[model samples]
Target: MVRSATTAEFRADLHAWLDVHEAELAPTYRGMGTLDEQIAQMQRVKAILYEADWMRYGWPERVGGLGGAAALRTELGASLAARDLMDPGHFSLVEVLAPTLIDFATPALAAEVVPSLLNGSEMWCQGFSEPETGSDLSSLRCRAVAEGDPSTATQWIINGQKVWTSLAHFSDRCVLLTRTGPPDSKHLGITAFFVDMDTPGITVRPIEMINGVREFAEVFFDDVVVSTDRILGSVNGGWAVAMSILPFERSSCFWQRIAYLYQRLQALTRLSEPTDRNAEIIGNAFLELHALRTRSRSTQHRLAAGATLGAETSIDKVLVAAGEHAVYNAARRLLHNTITLDDTVHGEQWRTEYLYSRSATIYGGTAEIQRNIIARRLLNLGDER
Candidate 1:
């Protein structure tokens, strides 16, 4: 299927549509809103866009989308972020998870669930990190045992725990990882599953962050019975599935975040009184953000051209974390005591964002881990010990 509009044309038309519908799309809460408010506002905006056909532009028609290059959806999201209609990180999750389903799930299953995600009827979470394993993904112990013969089993019973799963408590489904192989099998013996979160014997408890938001969760699966049909990719090929998601998460998903940061930077400028030191700091932050956007733009184009992204996106991961920290650090520097002391809604938002921004180096993948990937995979400088 072909997209009817050019990228620039789509951008112009989307902006015009948004201009006309500003009142309808505006959020009811102040500043960026709490996590609950953000989710509600995001879903409300998503449903409106889906209804108006704006949300369907980049996704395949088989998934209830109007087919086009995936980059078009990035444009949609960047625009929303620029205008403050939707949270960029929340909006970009489709790029991270939906494509995984399309590429790995049975066509019938992908067709059934992907539409629900795009239309704001369903939310999904990734279940990869564990309390014991952390970023050492191959050490995952969330076991899934076949109910009968391994080769022909129709049911698998899953039992284990997932920690730091973002929004698991609110998610309708999960793209989960399980240890299908032996305990010592490591990376070679995992599998991915598209499991319904409402299934019996599953529990979710949200984890409150330093920023006072319960954005992450601890999820437990106890003898949860899932059909063989729910496997995302081939058995023991979940390592491949895991690799496929990181590229999207680090690169494509970060584009709209760049837009969000740009907007926040502009807001920071408005709040700060101009000083010589402030000028230098904001200028440096702008340069770093520009670098991130330029690099991420190339990644989005590569995805548009159907290029396979691999360890190279670790560069994107590094830049996004760096850029995020730079922006908020600049905020703390320029705004000073306001960010640290104010208890007002507006001031609290800045303080919370500043706190959250500090964790950029830890989530998705750590800075040290990314630098190791860059050294080992991209630069070819390091030897494995």
Candidate 2:
């Protein structure tokens, strides 16, 4: 029976389920466990949520969803984070990449692929930033040339390199964007495709970041063949598809993450020593998180109301980055030596997260680029490039 519960009802029901499932969902491995273990744990939790139909809400019925208010999914993610069932940071890839597939992939493709992702039977990665194209993504150099028999067949042969591909080494497929036009084509002639990671001539090498964790990877594609049927949206029309992906990344994803950050801040407050400095830092972090949560609420409402987000959502991205940085900075200020010099398990987790927070300004879009967007597009200030 489909339980079309109200938000309050759903929350109560989910809480009850969690009370029983807590033991099963608890992380068996502590600090610095293998990435394989983390991923396996993520799948275990996802499978449970999917079977409960909590994972299906907010998604389309055509793609194995239950077809409810988007808030249902948001609440589900929040519950998972609050319960510490999964790492909010890593689980966010679904919120980032799934909507892109739903909006851009063919109906057949969405039906065939999205279930694998939602069920954790498969993992997907986004191929956006290259070495020289992090902030200026439109300037990517990955090339895709049209190929196959001219009469009845159509395809593209891709050859290029992508860097900073999050989870690429573990991904089963990638939502990739490649250049199909001249060097100066910019965003105009770019195309998007769903490419198999295990396809012939594709290589993925893990890139170790400052934290000594290889969470992201560099991917190389040489003569990677993709059928025209795999092309998302249209040949030169990928810019729109890419642009449409931003709202979910910025807003819906931001809300659940904010909830997780709040939980962490509260935990930090509990762990802090008795000092005025610690109190001030905790207060500041809390305020920043509060502002972010408020802003995020409106964005989530907009999304659920079916409004298309644009340059304005960049504000949400900025708030998220700032709030995340602030929270981690508070940890550093309060925990002090533990995060820096200590080699304990908890210290390592805090240290890793702090270093990862440095990239908060860089990922999704840089803090600089986001500010520029707010100035030009939202405030109607001077033009920025």
Clashing pairs in 1: none
For candidate 1, give the lDDT of residue 184.
96
Candidate 2 lDDT at 18 equals 85
Looking at model 1, residue 114 earns an lDDT score of 95
What residue runs in model 1 are displaced by over 4 Å at the alpha carbon? 1-3
lDDT of each: 0.89, 0.85
- Tens-place lDDT per residue, model 2, 254-335, is 8778888888898899998878988889999999999999999998888778888888888898999999999999999888
Q: Best candidate per lDDT, number?
A: 1
Candidate 1's residue-wise lDDT over 159-250, tens digit each?
99999998888799999999999999999999999999999999999999999999999999999999999999988999988888876787
Model 2 residue pairs with clashes: none
Instruction: After superposing candidate 2 on the true structure, give the runs of residues whose Cα lies further than 4 Å from its correct spot.
Output: 148-152
